[model samples]
Target chain A: MDEFELIRRYFAPLSGAHEDVVLGIGDDCALLAPPAGHELAVTSDTLIAGRHFPEESLPFDIGWKSLAVNLSDLAAMGARARWFTLALALPEADERWLAGFADGLKALADEAEVSLVGGDTTRGPLTITITALGVVPAGCALRRSGARVGDRVCVSGTLGDAALALERWRAGDRDRSDDALDLRARLDRPTPRLALGEALRGLAHAAIDLSDGLAADLSHLLRASGVGAHIYGARLPSSAAFDRLAPAAERTRLQLAGGDDYELCLCIPAARLSEVRRLAQQIGVALTDIGEIQAGSGLSVLGAQCEPLAFTELGYRHFQ
Target chain B: MDEFELIRRYFAPLSGAHEDVVLGIGDDCALLAPPAGHELAVTSDTLIAGRHFPEESLPFDIGWKSLAVNLSDLAAMGARARWFTLALALPEADERWLAGFADGLKALADEAEVSLVGGDTTRGPLTITITALGVVPAGCALRRSGARVGDRVCVSGTLGDAALALERWRAGDRDRSDDALDLRARLDRPTPRLALGEALRGLAHAAIDLSDGLAADLSHLLRASGVGAHIYGARLPSSAAFDRLAPAAERTRLQLAGGDDYELCLCIPAARLSEVRRLAQQIGVALTDIGEIQAGSGLSVLGAQCEPLAFTELGYRHFQ
Candidate 1:
């Protein structure tokens, strides 16, 4: 099919081709008439083969992960996903590859209620960049700088499973028939936590997504909020796969520094802990309190008496 | 400087630091509170090394062209350029490269009245993707399907200059000086014609930017408007470089098919021809009528006796 028709069948239907989007997929540019009295949350992510993912990763997973990662960023801000534009540069226009990729993209867009509005498809190395727009009530979106001292640090969903799955996948373990296979699939294709993020709006004082590992992402929130945090190693949620690798400290390290976690790291007032628990139940995601924002500088992991734990680096640096 | 510090100093200041931007550059997401009664226009473009440009292109030009190309899409839809988010995946965080790149981005952004709202920086291949947001008065944006049969087809500014510059740069043929060299610079850094787009809002029936050559981009408009057109090659506005090229037909071919001309292709009814000319003069740009939409399918190029012209290939195919 031609480019215009492809967008109409897959993208326009997801974007709804409705009044919310004044100009949808078929236009020269997408004219988005965002809902009145709401704020638009914008975020962009670029995924490159051999860099962001395995060079041999399936095209469908690539499409799913690229959009999923960007949606996670919006979720961190407590915004409801609305529309997205994709800029896909492929080495060649392989029909079978595109159909699979589009199927994966449509599946997530349909589930998230985000329309694939307008984008550019060019020839290049396999690269996909998605720009997602979400909406939140005026003056109510979550921010990284709102975390205050004495706030309990909470995270939605488990951590380190995706990283462990990546490690297992790299080791040539193709056992997808078991339960751990589901975890491996989740690593390949993440589910952006939009519902949980929306539910945490009034409950979360500060929020950030764990795309670059918990420690690195949490460091960003702490830095923006001008506070420090003390994470409890005993309380860090970890996958059994990671726990089997080394001692408890190393598993905690993985939970703290593993990239591609895609969980939400939020800070809520200590008094709001019960309410946070209730919201998590309503959203059907486990809420784990792993740390506390403190009136100091830098992040610290503690033993029973709150002494510092040691690690060579805080998290994965992409350059390294 | 680190990525965080660079963003705060260079980008945060450029985002206007206003209340409408609920979240600025430093957060996981940038929250934009769109003003009342206006629709947001969104478009994205990704420029990959050795694909969108030559491998040895300048970083400053890369930065300028990335945003300008997306802004051209906004202009095509008659959207007021508002803000943009950049997703940059680079091999390293070289301070000098970033300083020059940010300078070019800031320069163009300031001139277009577009702010740098938010983005993500990662270590990967040198890939630059920009998602631009614009605003159009409610129900006032020009679209690509508004053209009807018998409408006069017009184009703003001259064509083929960018392609000529790229050819010269590729061949190392730097024979000209002064104005010609400056004209070549225009190819590298295009003026998106935002003001001209806004001026044509009430006059032009349908419009699109001349991105993938005049013929290809106009073909898109024609396909969308469900009409055909006849155009004489001699009526097109061209540069003296066309005269320098051997064989007059070759010149005409390049003038028609050479891409990267960021001029606006506008369709106006016979009644609005004089008004189109007036707006072009007010905007200090040329508007030349070279064709008309007809009740037919497919584009036809007219010769002395309206004979069809043949081409070795159609204008660019992105995934070819």
Candidate 2:
């Protein structure tokens, strides 16, 4: 199969039936109509083979994760994903790979109700670039610069599981235990917290999705909002797999600074904590109160007895 | 510098001062307000290091052409350029390269009035993916499926210069003559026909940008419109450089099938011909009447004496 054939057979069918998508694949450009009173949220993310995922990763996982990461950005902005374009560069037109990729992409796209409207395919080292568009009411979208000094910082879902899985894989611990498989699944197929993010629009003062670990991502939010934060190390949420398999020291390190978790880190008013928790419960995700925004600069972590823990910045940095 | 610093220092300033951009870089997602009564046109294109351009090509050319191709798609749709997102993958953090790339990208973006709303940077083999969004009045966007029998075919600007430049470069004809430099410039900085495309919106029955050569790209428009066309080979536009340097047979071959011209190929009703020509002249582009659309499918090229030319599909195809 060639580029056009691959697109016609695998990608074209992924363009979902959405009323707002006036035109989709096979056109020079995809025409879209954004509803009145709504602004568009746009985000772009690229996942390169070997740099992003393992070189041996399944095509399905790469496809799922590529779109998932972009959607996570929309979730952080309290936006409803509407459409996305995939610019894919591959070494060859492998039919099986394309089939698996399209399947994985369609699975999440169906769940998110987002359409694949347009894309470009070319020959090169494997890379997937997805630009996702979402809609949010004007003046109601969450932003990283809205965190206030008195806001309580919260995160949806558990942290560090993806990082833990990656660590195990890198360490050559390929034992296929149920816990290991579960951890691997978390690393491969992260759930974009769209529902939780949209629900927190009026309740949360600021929001950001955690990709480069909690320490690094939260610091970005703090820097943008010009506020500091302190979290109790003992209060960090951990998955059952993480608690059972990871060492105590590694647990804290991974939770604080290991990357790849697609959870939302948000700053909500203290008075809205119960309501936020209730919404999290309704959404079926753990919304942990991890820290409190402070007036100073930088982040600090407190130990079990409230003594400040030594901090290290170990977030992932590209081209380092 | 790491990815964050690279983005902050080099890429962020490309975010133009556009009111529709409620939020740009430094956020998880860029917030954009599409104007009321207009629909958005979105397109994505990727240019890989060795595949799309010579591996030794300048970073400036790479950046400029990467965005140009995407805007070309919007131009084909007769949309006014607005905002874009870039996904870049680089092997290393090279400040010099980044600076040159940014300068090239900003030049065209500033002229086109398109803002860099958001982007992603990662470590990998050099790849650049850009997704551009534009707006056109609802139900007024030009499409490939609007051609009808007897519609006059027209094309803007010259063709074959870029392909000839590549041919010369590959044959090691690196003469520093003005013609050689001009051909090289065409290869590197093919102009996007934004003004001509926007002007052709109501005048043209169907339109497409000549990227994969007139033969292949026009075939696509014909397939979409379920029509056929016959163009006079002698009427195909050629730059002065091309006419002066290329041999007779090669000239016809290249003009008919060469790619990367970035010119618009439009099918206009015979009644609208003079108006489109006038608009093209106003936009400072050459509008040539090539032929007329036919009732059947596929394209046919007529030689100088009006005899049907034996056509060969030498147009660029990935993974061929």
Candidate 3:
């Protein structure tokens, strides 16, 4: 389908059903009239060619991941997906590639309940930028600065599976050596835990998505909250994907420094840890007690014996 | 300045001194209440290197034009400027370039009263994408589908100057000719005509921006409205820059087929013509009567004596 037809099919229905939305995908502008009790959360991210992903990655994955990453940012703030706009640049518009990309994008966007309100497509080296807007109760969104020294740092779902899967894919293992087909899919389609994030409202003092790996993402929370962290290395969730393929130290490195994991990393106070756990259970996602916020300026990793450990290459830097 | 400092300095107060904006630009997101009585208008556009603009173009100009184009989209729908988010991609984080770009962007944004709410920056070939959000009274947005046969098609401000300026820049005549300076600036920073758009809200039956040139953008409106247009060529607006350089025939070519002028093209009903003219004067932006919606399936251009004129390259093709 051409861009217009594709948009009409997938995006028109999203706005057609929502009372809060005043307009949708057909016109030059999508009109929004958010309900009175809600506040808007907005975030944007861009992924460029020969970076962010493998040089020859499927266009469909690129499309899905582009929107998914931005959605994760909204999730980190405990917001509900509402609308999104896309800016896509490619060498040229190929019908086959566009169809597949649209299909993949629509599948994910439909699942997230995000209306594709507007977008622009043009010619350039393939770059996809998605800006997503979400809604939250007024003055109730979670933020990084709300974390306290006594807060227990927690992560939703498993960590490092995406990174391990990427390692295998980069090495041309394709999830075979470690038999990590599921892990590889997790890496390819790292679902943003939006429901869990929304559920963590009033419980999480600080929240972040593990897009740039847990080590670096945690560092941002600590910096924002003016605290440090002591993460138990053994407490980090690891699957069989790591056991068969990577050495202990290397696995730890992957778990800490690897990127593209869209899981949520949150900080809950000691008094609210049980509530956070119960909420995770309600959402059917695993809640791992990864560490605790400390009154310092850096992060320390604890061994199985409970001794502190150090690391290098904290996480991926886009410029680096 | 670092990102945080830059954000605080440039974007912190975009929510306005008024309370309609429930959230401003400093947090992980910006929140909007939408002023209780208005419908929101949203549009996005992306400018990429070696494609949307010439490679020799200035970064500041790129910033201005990028935001202006999206603003023009809002103007087409007769929407009032409210807020916008910018996404910039550059090869590296150069403080000098950032300063200049932000300065230029803020200049136009402030003039339009379109607040700069939020955005993202990354490492890549320079790309500027902006999503402009504006407000229009409920049931009053001038859309493409509202045009009808016998409607007086009017255009605001001048046309063809930006397109001619682009040709001049492409031919490298921009620097040597002092006369081309204004033309170059037109190409670099076409105004969005927000005041005219706001004034035309009730008078316009249909409207669109002259970004892809008057011919293409109008074609989009006529197509959307399922009508045809009869535009008088002699009645079109031309700049002194065009008269001083290009021949009359070339100027006609520019007016007919060149893109990026960013003027507002609208269709007003025959009955509302006088009222529309009054509103245009009230806004102080010239509103020219250039065409009329006709009950046919194709656009026809009339010369000085009302005879038909022919042209090539009707407008830009997205894939090409």
Best by DockQ: 2
Scored by lDDT, the top model is 2
Q: Using lDDT, rank the candidates from best to worst.
A: 2, 1, 3
Tens-digit per-residue lDDT, A1-320, candidate 2: 67788889999989999999999898899999999999999999998888788888888888899999999999999999999999998888888998998988999999999999999898888899999999999999999999998899999889989999999999988969898888888899889999998999998999999998898889889999999999988899988988999887688888988888999999999999999999999989999998899998888889899988877433434312
In terms of lDDT, the poorest run of 10 residues in model 2 chain B is B311-320
Order the candidate numbers by TM-score, best to worst. 2, 1, 3
Clashing pairs in 1: none
What TM-score would each prediction reach against the true structure?
Answer: 0.91, 0.97, 0.91
Tell me the tens digit of each residue's lDDT in model 1 across B96-146: 787777877878988887778887777767888899998888888889998
Candidate 3: where are CA atoms >4 Å away?
A1-22, A172-178, A312-320, B1-28, B175-178, B311-320
Question: iRMS of each prediction in angstroms?
Answer: 1.3, 0.7, 1.7
Best by TM-score: 2
Stretches of candidate 2 exceeding 4 Å from the true structure: A313-320, B313-320
- Whole-model Cα lDDT of every candidate shown, in order: 0.80, 0.90, 0.78
Clashing pairs in 2: none
- Give the 10-residue window scoring lowest on summed lDDT in candidate 3 chain B: B311-320
Tens digit per residue, CA lDDT, model 2, B161-275: 9989988888888888998889989989878999988988888889999898888889999999999999998899888898888877688778877789999999999998988
